[model samples]
Target chain A: MTMSEAIEGRAALALLERARAVVDPPLRTALDTLPGPLRRIALYHFGWEDADGAPADGGAGKAVRPALVLAAARALGGDPLTAVPAAVAVELAHNFTLLHDDVIDRDPTRRHRPTAWTVFGVADAVIAGDALFALALRILAEDPHPASAAAAGRLSACVIELCGGQQADCAFEGRGPREVSLAECVEMAIAKTGALLGCSCALGALYAGAEPERIAALDTFGREAGLAFQLIDDLIGIWGDPARTGKPAGADLVAHKKSLPVVAALRSGTPAGAELARLYRTPLTGADVRRAADAVERAGGRDWAQLQAADRMAGAVQELSRAVPDPAAAGDLLDLAEFVTRRSR
Target chain B: MTMSEAIEGRAALALLERARAVVDPPLRTALDTLPGPLRRIALYHFGWEDADGAPADGGAGKAVRPALVLAAARALGGDPLTAVPAAVAVELAHNFTLLHDDVIDRDPTRRHRPTAWTVFGVADAVIAGDALFALALRILAEDPHPASAAAAGRLSACVIELCGGQQADCAFEGRGPREVSLAECVEMAIAKTGALLGCSCALGALYAGAEPERIAALDTFGREAGLAFQLIDDLIGIWGDPARTGKPAGADLVAHKKSLPVVAALRSGTPAGAELARLYRTPLTGADVRRAADAVERAGGRDWAQLQAADRMAGAVQELSRAVPDPAAAGDLLDLAEFVTRRSR
Candidate 1:
């Protein structure tokens, strides 16, 4: 990687962490309003405390989405702090999804720690997630901003779409590899992951009183970046380092997940594709997961996904350019978009 | 019951059915926005369709909550049709709770039919419930009225309280009956059930541009009615005819639920209370459930609950009188409150 790119990436990461720090107090305060156990579950899930209510260094997530909200506001010539509620809402909704997804996926760990469902039990975790969802909307609905209704509406719409996408993703797991097309998988990823990211950016722009055209442009930028993020995430799921990713190598393959690259490989119709499909039809584990990853890569799945993500990044930058006009003004969001695709985890 | 009161009850039931009919189309349209499988599950749950998606007499719920919404609007001299969106939101939120509660309670049946979680898998049912919740908030957020924000905020707050109440109820199930107090049980019931009823009426009044005093008065009326409704529900759970209630006879006793009456009975510290406690400590089925119900009755649980419900109904009527002033104008809402306390199922 170029030295200049590395410096830019570091700066972008710093911006993300700073923005997250700025939103933490209000986010925590908002969550504090939930009933005791539900609040504890949320606090634990957010890496703020332990299951026993002790302090812990359970790492915060990268905060890319919240950063996008703040960045979008600044790019639209508005005070980033004005969009703090939007940032908080997006972060809370993201965590809500994480808690529920952990339950739905039955994953035991997240961010190098036990998932909240494991600690609090599934029922409490599920209910807590619901509370957080309600809280996210409540914050926006009760906000004094004139744009709150639009923002809340968009956020809820995005969440419903996310649920639909998650349903589709779960459905795909029960099917044979060849049954799901690349188009369908991509659509699911866009809905499940991209919609919220886009909504995050658009909400900030909306709160900033940006023109509809600018809001739409920023939304497009965020969606494209989200797609890129998902593509890279799928790549990491298949072949990431366990030490770096905080999960077993090929964890998705072991779970027989119909991830984007896996679906792409199966849809390739090549000899490797046929082999990968046969392997996926059987339950996979241990050596088989490793073998499956090799087959996916051999079918050009890795290269195809990498190229697609790069294309998405390019598209995201194009959208950002249309919205911001001045290249210098768009630096943080653009760097963050690049950082998303470049991350190993 | 007095002949005049019985007539009023019949009229109230008729009003409930009429309100259910009025809200049906919009509610159905809202459900239609969900994806195919989720929509089908909701439709089946609502008694509009059979498991196979064919039309059936699945039977709408008594529509008591929706009726309260419309009746409150009318009592405040607002057009009932103007409050349709509020009615739709409340009903959707109510059903959303039912879906999640079925999963949390692990009950196989609801309304004498297979629960959604059993028909669909638990995960899908959960995600669908989440979608419905988001849709409920979305409906209010997108409403044209200036009161939409306030209504949405209140509804979300009530839901969080409901979650907390459910958490408490579930927690109580793990303890001996004597470990819980009547006050705690009543508080749980109020949060779990009364908060939504209050919010429904309050939303209607808010949408009608009612004064804050009237809104508060109507909220109190609905909450009092909700408490009475729950007290009667506890009674029915213990002794109602299975054929009419669509549940097994003495279901609550069989499950050892620390319901309001059971808590009251246990807290009485009488010989019958001791026997009821002993029976609850052990698992019960068949004749044991009937014996448990008998013990609860002998402990004065039945009489106590009946009197409490009557008192609550009186309080509800008083509140309604204060809000509406003219007794005739408040008649429909008063009848609905009375009907809630007098229901057989």
Candidate 2:
């Protein structure tokens, strides 16, 4: 597909940039209110500071959810900027989940630095996350002035999905290979990851004056896209090169993570399944990663996962086609979709 | 107050009773979707289980915040049942904070059993808190119509206050006596503990079709009353009998927690204050608790706190007089205020 034909690609990026300005003030106000140490850490995590907490240009983070929110608003033919609450709300929601996920997963580095809980201590980090969670709701409460109750309620649903997804992800940590069915994993991904992304876009549409039907369709598209993205990400987590991953290669293999490929290999009940099972029983070290990766490859686990990701991508594309009637915004959305699933980052 | 009067005093309690019917089915539905082990842990934390994860009647809690919410609605002359969503939201919000607080404080017992994080890992408890946090918001989202936005926004504002208060409380941990003054500590308590209580009632009033002025008045009354309730709590934390506190005697002193009385004593700048400061400079053990308590007593800390609490109680009474015009509900509110501060619980 041509770049211009993607789902509001340029428009989504532009919308995200515009929404950033709107979200900045309340966020800064919140940061300002925080005591010196916590405020510094939080600002740094938001990509606003250097290691020493001095001010810096934008650090890291694509702000994808916020962008999708704005694009959804624009697709609804409304002032995307007017949906700033939804945009900021989604971004805050994203970071809050990320911080918690890091704590739960024990993956210390976030945006290539110490996680919030790691640097600030768990007590402070938890409060920081709660702070962001509150800020998100406050941002949403600002708009729909007369409809603040309903808007706030919408935020709760998103939080439930986001939090529930994280819970399910943690619960699945020690799952047996057979238990990690592609369908189950996809559903988990949707709950854990897609919920916020989908809800953000849907909320954007809602705030932008879209009908419920339109909002529902856009949400479907967003959910599908988010799920597909995660599936592809799981694939990368296992076999992707260290340079691309910004960490050691075969990290998931060494950890014996139940990614889609490994789970798929197990489900196939082929030669790869037996080998994968045997390999998992032993503690995986760096030396064993090659054999582990080979077991999945020989089992066609990699190919199957690739195929599954393709199917989800197709589903996402189909939803996008049906939801976005506006040519400009639709093109931008498509670009974002392609960029999100296809790129290394 | 009489037992029956205490039972009837809190308007929000009636709302909570009503909320039980409204929230039960939906809460169960959400719980059903969670994984088995997680569902059980979260259920236990919600008071649905005994320590062994077996079902028990102890799932019932005091429902204080919810009662406050309903009372505010009634004080506003609105139907208490109409505020059921707000009632459930505030109760859930209160519980969510408690779950996390237990983890951070490293306290083992909650409602006379091991805390959720103590039984389940910290990660599990964190996720469970997330579930409840989400649940609180989701409960509000059921307003079923867009016109409910005002109520949603009000709940969101309450949530922000809840978070901000928690932040202040956590920030207090490492602060020196000078960094957090007694007045500031009281202000923090008002924001942290009182705000949610006030918010509960205010939202209840909003939901009950009350005029904005009445809602505002009820909020002010609830805020002052909540602060009074917390001051009494601070007193109990340090001085209440072990049987009443369900904690070791002088638990606050053991933790070096800067309770209001302790802060007050430290600020007195008398011999007792100087003595207390010296003891505070040393790591506290159970032995030190006795010394600290003695020092506080000598400095007139206990008396000062009691007087301050009385001042807050009077302020609450004054606020209630101005906020609630209706004799019956206002009377109930006052009775409840007396019950909360006077009773050991």
Candidate 3:
């Protein structure tokens, strides 16, 4: 990329990050309302504190979803303050999924630290996740905006779809390679990853009193961006450096996870695909994790995922164009999308 | 009780049951919107179907919470239809807790059948519970009533409290007997059981456009009834017949569950209390279960719990009188409370 373009992208991304930072105090205050030790677990999970309830120099998440909320609000010419609760609600809902997802996946680590379940046991972790889900809805419902009810309804519907997607992903793991399809994997990814991102933008539009068509366009853009994000994430799971990813190299491959790339490779029907399938049939050790990553690439999975992500990003920009009409107004959203894909590169 | 009083009590109790039966169609329709296999698990859990999705001649729950919604609405002199969504939402929320509770408690059976987690596995059950939680909020958010937002907000807050209470209960289990107190146990019970019931009544009152003070009174009534119901339930968990309770005799004793009666006995400072505490220090066997139950009774645990339940029931009646004012309007709720305690007798 050219130097000017890189600087513009960073500026746009920084703007979104700054907008997300606006949601932190309200989000923390909302979570603090939870009675008893659950507040401690929530605070610790959000990287605000250590296990002992002491403050730590912890990092928050990427805050991409909250940024989408604010950017979409700005794109629609609405007061960003009206969308603040929506942003916080989306972030809370996102973290709720993360907490439960870690438990469901039996993941021991997140964001370079031990998972909440590992720190506080499974039952409390799950309960804390549920509490956060309720708090997210409560935050939206308590907002004084006229659109609060509709926003709460849409966000919850999105959550329902998200859970359904997670269930589908879990079910896929128990199935044979032949029983799985790329289409199914993509659908699950859309529900599991795309739904919340789409909801974030749609909620922002809703808060802005944007026209339904505009909201739909923004939702489409966010959903496509989310798909691109997931495609890149799957690639990172197999090949990205652990230092950058904050996960062990080839973590998904080692678990024989049915990620988009893995499903794509297994369906490639090449000799390498067949070999990869055989390896997946049984458990793998440390050595096999590296071999499996190479096998996926050899089966053309890496190239296909990368191409799909680019295509999805293009589609996202198309939807953004439809929503914004003016290219200049759409510039920041486009830059944010560019930055997302740029991370994988 | 006199025959006339028994007859009057049965008739009033019948009114609430009839109202609950009215909510079934709407409740089932709401659940049907859940995606694919989740709907199946939910249907099976509610005892509406067999594991294979075939219709079963099964019984639904007592629907006590739903009854409170309708009865509370009636007492406020409003159309019960206005509160139907609230009733459905509360019932859904109650079942959401049941699904997750079974998983957390690792109980194999519920409502005379295998629990959802046992039938569908843990992950799906947890996800299914989450879906119900979302669906509950969705139902309220979609309601046309102006009070929908407030009802949704209150219900979500109650759910947050319920999670905190469950967290405390779980935490207590890991601690020594001396670490737990009656006050703490009571507070947990209020949160875990009372909060939802109180929210049910409050939602109904909110739907009726009742004044805040009136809503608070109704909430207090429901909360106290919930406490009484829990006390009786704890007693049944220990001493009730297995055939009648659909559980093993002295099931809590066998598990050394720190139930209200058990905690009370352990705190009694009597010789029987010490013996019971000693027995609880080790896992119980076939004969030990009966001895434990006897020791709890000898420590005045049984009498204490029974008296506490009556006291709470009286307090519930006092609150009900404040809300209803007219004795006739309070009849159904009073009867429901009577029936709850009668089950233990």
Candidate 4:
């Protein structure tokens, strides 16, 4: 909202746009290798084509992960052009999770359109997701970069952690609100969201031929930033405007999603937290959704989430400084990180 | 059945047992890297543990794919022991497919026990399968062999093809019996069943440092043998004894599975084919299953599948000979190929 924040936002947008410009061609080429039926589904999922196989201009996403890959590489003194494959691979891997998660979650829409599973059926969507993941690894395998194998290893391991995180998220949905702890919820957030972001940065550092310690520092930086992003997103999920988030207010509350703040509230042990748990015990109606949101706020969930986001961003900046000592060199990475945590939608 | 056949069968069994001995330890080690929840599902899926997490001796399926990997390496004059990672990776990839296919097809059982999806629920099974796939690639990426990168590329591409084949198979389920062409069915079989078998051999050949042409030949060898195996398995699905197959007779017919033989029969353009189509249109009762089996036979589906299996075996031998000219050197590969096609279950 301030002048410097506005400048950082624009700078982050420009970086993301540049990443998509370099990453899209190779990403499309990799996807074109898929057989016809699978290709169609993947193209549709990426917003490049319609369900009827027509071309569409629907945006894929903000390309935040890819931007991080390029920015980290540049920050570490690598050619961003040479790391394009890493960027493409990271984007592909991120979208793979989106397709499968949409199916598992059974929510209808994504990227302001019907989810792939809704348009093409669950079986096709699942298979398309599998193919996307394979294509991601294939890109790394085929890359002639000296760091390709190591990047592949990190990416593959990150995917496993991502799956574990998703499995835990689903498992949490079946239990009572008070059954999940704040620590467990944070772990899930790191695994589900932070792992890939960390992987993206680590891959960039790998391509940059940085030292192992530097790579580890960049990974930590991205992970902390990713956690901050998730915290803000969770807050938005509860209080975000429908016009911006494209969902009803308190959508997570209505679905009884055990998001970070909701779990934090339930574990707070305040009277308001107990009231929120009672509301969560049944299917939430219109009035109950509002009541639950109020209880979460009154129990200090909102304040806790805001403070945690700021703390995580601070940790992220500290780690970034360790990896890239010069503030000027770290400017783009810092801009992108701040942009993600500041997003309202 | 005959003196030479009996010897070959026992030799193949011994080879499989040896493969399991070498491959299981590393496979278990790789799987052990999974988080506790995911490891439990994978262990149960592999028949290493009960659904309740107790260690059980429920045998994992015969290590046929791993045996082929080692046999292919040895056939090409490489030290099979050094190819253990390839063997472990191939087995992991094979099990990954098994887990996903069971979920997609909603099959209730595998290896004579309840399927993982049925026991752990669909979400956990899906996540477990994804983790297994990631672990498979991680093994290849971490291998220090000169050929590990090339092998990873081939394996990743093969996984994409496998997904394509599975997608085609699911699509066929919604069409009429007469609508799916025999050629389409055969292509699907090759993609679904033969592709991974070929990949397993190709990966071994890569690890062996074989020439590209030799690797291609070995891949073809495995694929042809795999097709023959599928054809024989399809025949058994309709006609094999219940005691041997662990299923009722005509199980595929009961489920209206448009397997290779059934598709061939439906496209035969004979009165018996028409009768079979009618039987397929409605749910088959006990007597109807018998009639459908008779119709497929009269339509020449049984003879066609048998002759095709033999022809495929011959093609497999030709390809194997191209890769491994000496009969003595090719013996193990031949034994495993024959064992698979000769299986009744």
lDDT of each: 0.88, 0.73, 0.88, 0.93
Against the true structure, whose lDDT is highest?
4
User: Could you give the candidate ranking by TM-score, starting with the highest?
Assistant: 4, 1, 3, 2
The clash number for model 1 is: 0
Instruction: Write model 1 residue lDDT over A227-343, tens digit each, in one string.
Output: 999999999998888998888989888877888899899999889999998998788888888889999999999999999998988899999999999888888888888887788
Best by TM-score: 4
Q: What is the C-alpha lDDT profile of model 2 across B1-345, one tens digit per residue? A: 676765655553554455565555555566665556667777788778776867876555666666676667677677776666676667667777888889887888887778999988888888778767766666666665332456556665666566666677878877875467887788778877788777777777777776777778778877888888887888888889999767788888777788888888888878998898888878877778889899998998899888888898888787777777567768656766666677664
- Stretches off by above 4 angstroms in model 3 are A239-251, A269-272, A282-300, B246-249, B284-299
- Ordered from best to worst DockQ, the candidate numbers read 4, 3, 1, 2
Please, what are the lDDT tens digits per residue for candidate 4 over residues A194-292? 999999999999999999999999999989999999999999999999899888989989989898999999999999999999999999988999999
Off by over 4 Å in 2: A1-39, A50-52, A145-154, A177-179, A326-329, B1-39, B51-53, B144-148, B176-179, B246-248, B282-291
**Clash pairs for candidate 3:** none
Instruction: Give Cα distance to truth, residue B232, candidate 1, Å.
Output: 1.3
What is the overall TM-score of model 2 with all chains considered together?
Answer: 0.91
Per-prediction interface RMSD in Å: 0.8, 3.0, 0.6, 0.6
Residue pairs clashing in model 1 are none
Candidate 4 lDDT tens digits, B162-258: 9999999999999988999999999999999999899888878888899999999999999999999999999999999999988898999999999
lDDT of 1 at A76: 85
